[model samples]
Target: MAATEITLEVARYRPGVDSEPVLQSYQVPLREHWAILDGLTYVKDHLDGTLSFRWSCRMGICGSCGMTVNGEPQLSCATFLTDYAPGPIRVEPLHNFPVVRDLVVDIDDFMTKLPKVKPWVIREVQSPIEEGEYLQTPEEMDECQQFSMCINCMLCYSACPVYSLEPDFLGPAAIALAQRYNLDSRDEGADERRDVLSSPEGIWACTFVGECSAVCPKGVDPAGAIQRYKLTAATQSIKELLMPRSLIPRSKG
Candidate 1:
């Protein structure tokens, strides 16, 4: 017969109470359809009322249920408890981030760095309202569509070794989102983003570990985006060396 229950070793941290995070174990029914998030919910409702975590849409689209499950970054809402059957499963806040309460982590660093990349369509001059929206061909859309799939889930950042060591790094999600806009045919802010993208703490800091891509639940390859941006930055540097800035054509808006 299959196991009837599973033990979850969840990390708990409460400010002014616990000196450090402690693992608290709880047993919940093992159902085939139940996910790790469901197990956590069970603990909160039935086992421990003070258990805390962040989750919105149970669907993977929200990307808010990201956490470390058994030493790997995963979306607790999508990772079923049945996968790790017959034993204890560990759940903790995402790596490389400060734990807020229990499974909740402080993402203020990422929030501040995201805007620095200016991940939005920018135009020096905007057309009047009567002009309608800017249009793009399917081919043009394909250039940045992969990067646009990122839901700002910091899983990539948590899996990235570089971000763990260097907190100043702009991080995979921010860089990938930056490429989403930089590659957009209607965007003209490539030059404006050049300073941040090419800085020492930006793409240069990424060692291309590829963990950022491996752990991306959305199938987005942040490692590839960073590499592509590096090439673009290098080409721009060569052009500047060969010709004057005034002669170099500005990126199309």
Candidate 2:
């Protein structure tokens, strides 16, 4: 196999000028170890300076380089160029989001939806100034630690058919974050959180497409968190109907 010379068929769009996106090709030199991000960088530096994409930390940790490589959600940094190279490789911004420019999509919609989920540990009460930290056993942290790896890349949203079909769906990352708080022993917002989870745009929109889990670079199984949230939500609903007292979260007092 040749080490260099691979064609990248990149999607191009200038928002106000173009009706829709179009493909433009660029020839980039590839090494077996070179990531797709490097290929895009080469194309941008040499050929098309207008091509846009997001990348940070060149390591896979940032998740900013997420995009669709040949119709599949992937981290450009993690995806090797030679893996798909005999010739042209199709690259585009993540699907199910509005394109801001060529291959750059606007993630403001996701950022807007995230805060509504209350993705934080709500302490029952503020600790004293002398208090140092909230300690957790290994088991306690392990219960929900895996969900915290999300880098907010929106690849899961891109892979999610539900988010694409229903624009209002709360989506994988937010749901995963919601689960993150729900599982934390320090959080006390479980009952208050139901309004977001039970609404039309919430968990019901998901059809278990599981593409979010499959495409996750950090192995954060959003599908599993969503399922657990559904289960917890159902149990809460049942308890509220029967016991009534359980509908309200226990107060720290």
Candidate 3:
């Protein structure tokens, strides 16, 4: 027999009132189709209207509903409540970030670090509007396609042990997004992004624990992206040492 009700132990925090977060339990209907987000919604609507969390789209595309579900970083909308079965389901804010209220975390650090990598195409001179859009072949698009799937959900950051230990680490999503723009044939920003990506806080900070890729709901292999960039950075360093600056071809952006 399947249990109809399940206890959701959701973390609760209210600034200026609560010094720290506390787990508040709520009994919710455990339908087969009920996701963790659905249970949370039910709790908010019926049990406690003061319970706070961030969720949008509710379909996993918005990446706004990311939270720690049973010790794993996951999108609440995609994590079914029935999977946990007959008991309490632990739900909390993503790790390595300051909890704003309950499930909502402060993403100010990620937002600040993202722009440092210049995750955009760089062109020394803009082409005239009449020149039309920059074209890319299938092969060219494939180079950066895998890395471009990141939606900035910050799940990778939550799963990364390095980010937890070192708050200044550039983090998995930001590094992978940098690789996305770097590998894009239409983008010439690789040279511009190299300084940040090769810095102490960037790819070097990642110890290849690979939890970032494991927690990613978008199937983006951020660990692999970091490895790829490390190789590229290393190769560039070798060339710079062996070849004269004038002799080495400059990257045309």
Candidate 4:
């Protein structure tokens, strides 16, 4: 029997150390069911200790293993080596973010944007805690269920061209999170968020390339959500002109 040899091309760079980021190659033996994270670990343990990357859950929950594998944002733990096995695999830091180290990126920008969107429920009506859990029928929950699956892996952010071209575009992940709360039946703050998201820094910046939906690991259609938000905002503008707030227009209401 012979060992299965795999070649990995990893992106490397260090501030004030390396002139520019370069791809460094490593060769290793792999098992049948080896994840991409295992390959990285093997290289770190035997080949190079200086290689920098991030990973927490060996499974796929934490989303810490997110990186661009051959130009696609993916979880190293979830992406199997055999799935892309021929000879060489290219691994690099996630895109649409500033690089902090080799495979590490500064997530402060992402965190700041996420919080700006208010990714939690904002209910105008506060019910008693003793009344039991916030009640939502299956249909109501379904409206925002897909948005809830976002693991914040930020693959959608990396895949978005709007983020790369215009860094202030509010991006996909934040927009999706905002939609998550807005679509909630218990939330009455959609109107409040519309002002912010309608700004130049928000959903209006998206050019509708639709790549965000394609790269999402959790099946969150961020592009669709943003488009729906745009539609809703447009509808509200027209309704406001034709009908006053005091008068009850059933469609606007």
Candidate 5:
């Protein structure tokens, strides 16, 4: 019997040397347990020293090794090579962002947008140390638990068609994280975040193509979060029209 072998068609781009990305192929031993990340490691260790990509934890938690596998955004650590066996597998950097190098897309866009959403519990005033920690019911925790699983892999951003078409869009992951903090029982910063999420470049820019949810390795449904926020925003608008300004809690910057 012969050992199984697989070919990887990896995209390569060197800043000044290459005009555009080109596919570079490498053959590696195929073990049923080996993932696409492992294949890349094999290439880096034994074959090519100059090849570049990002990875950490290799267990799918760090989310640093996201790339396009067969044209779909995936955490290479979680994607098994056996799934695309018997031939060459195509791997490339994530889409909708500037490529920094071979198989590494720049995440500066996400870093800029993520902070605007303030993906943490915000308070009008900090509790005194003697007051102890803020508490929440299980139900309150459950509300944002799923969205909190985001690993910031940028896979959702790469999968988002709206982000691809409109670079200014607030995007799925950031909006989802915003909702996560806003829904927290201890958070009082929803009003502070309202302007950002309600802006033209925010949730409204999302056309609900839902690809962001499809490629999420953590099962975080960013599309659903955006849709839910839309409903909340619309209802608030209706109330503002029918009621007095003093009766409603106006969102503050």
Candidate 6:
């Protein structure tokens, strides 16, 4: 039998009021088209205005509404309640990060780490203003197109056991974003990003658990990116070691 209404077991927490997060249930009308985010909106609008969560662009582009649904990380705006059917649904803040309140996890950690990987194009020299834009071949665009889809949803981080265990880990999304720029023919920043990404807590920290790729709604395979970085870093190290001592560049004191 199809359920007319579904119960949402939403996690609730307030800094001074609650010592720990608690699940609060609310029966919401089960519309086939309604997503879990809609149910949360209904709760905020009618049942409890105090209920807190994060959401934007209800279309899943913003990636702000990421949360643990039935123990799996997902964007609430894109997850249909009808899929679960006939009963209650569990919703909690994303794992592997500190919760800000209720469904909002503190993303400051990721924000801080993102810049360290330098997820942007770099050029050794500045082009003149009249020179127009840097061009890339079709193949070049294709090289980074898949990785460019990441929305910073952090679902990958939540699903990553390595990141959960080691907070310093550069993590899947950051490394993949770095690769996104690194693969760009217009970007000459691979060497700049390599130092941070090749460090102990970067790509090497990933054990290729692949859960990061599995949980990504955008289809960005962060695991593959990490593996690629490992190979590239290893090959560069070998070349440097093999090069004659006289040919190696040295910095002046």
Q: CA shift at 230, candidate 2, in angstroms?
A: 0.7
Q: Which parts of model 6 have CA positions greater than 4 angstroms off?
A: 244-253
Tell me which residue pairs clash in candidate 6: none
For the record, the alpha-carbon RMSD of candidate 4 to the native fold, in angstroms, is 2.1
lDDT of every predicted structure (CA atoms): 0.93, 0.86, 0.91, 0.85, 0.91, 0.91
* Tens digit of per-residue lDDT, candidate 6, span 1-253: 6669999999998989889999999999999999999999999999999988999899989989999999999999999999998769999999998988988889998999999988887888989979999998998799999999999999999999999899999999999999999888888778778789999999888899999999999999999999988998887777789996467443110
Per residue, candidate 5 scores C-alpha lDDT tens digits across 133-250 of 9999999799888989999998999988889989999999999999989888888988788899999999899989999999999999999999999988878878989998579874
Q: Tens digit of lDDT per residue, candidate 1, span 1-253?
A: 8889999999999988998899999999999999999999999999999999999999898888899999999999999999999869999999999999999999999999999999999988998879999999999999889999998889999999999999999999999999999889999999899899999999999999999999999989999999999988888789999999999887532
Question: Number of clashing residue pairs in every model?
Answer: 0, 0, 0, 0, 0, 0
- Clashing residue pairs for model 1: none
What tens digits encode model 2's per-residue C-alpha lDDT throughout 1-253? 4556898999999989999999999889878788899999998899988888889899988778888999999999999988996868999989999999988898989999999989987766879869978778898788778998998988999999889989999999999988887887777776667799778799878888899999999889999988888877777667778887745665321
Off by over 4 Å in 2: 1-3, 246-253
Clashing pairs in 4: none
Clashes of 5: 0
Residue 28, model 2, lDDT: 91
46: Cα error in model 5, Å:
0.2
> In model 6, what is the error at residue 4, expressed in angstroms?
1.2
**Which candidate number has the best lDDT?**
1
Worst 10 residues of 5 by lDDT: 244-253
If scored against the real structure, what TM-score would every candidate get?
0.97, 0.94, 0.96, 0.93, 0.96, 0.95
* Candidate 4 lDDT over residue span 49-115, tens digit each: 9999999988888978889999899988988888777758999999988888999988888888888
Looking at model 3, residue 192 earns an lDDT score of 84
Put down candidate 3 lDDT per residue, 170-241, tens digits, no spaces: 999999999888888888778888899999999998899999999999988999999988888887789999
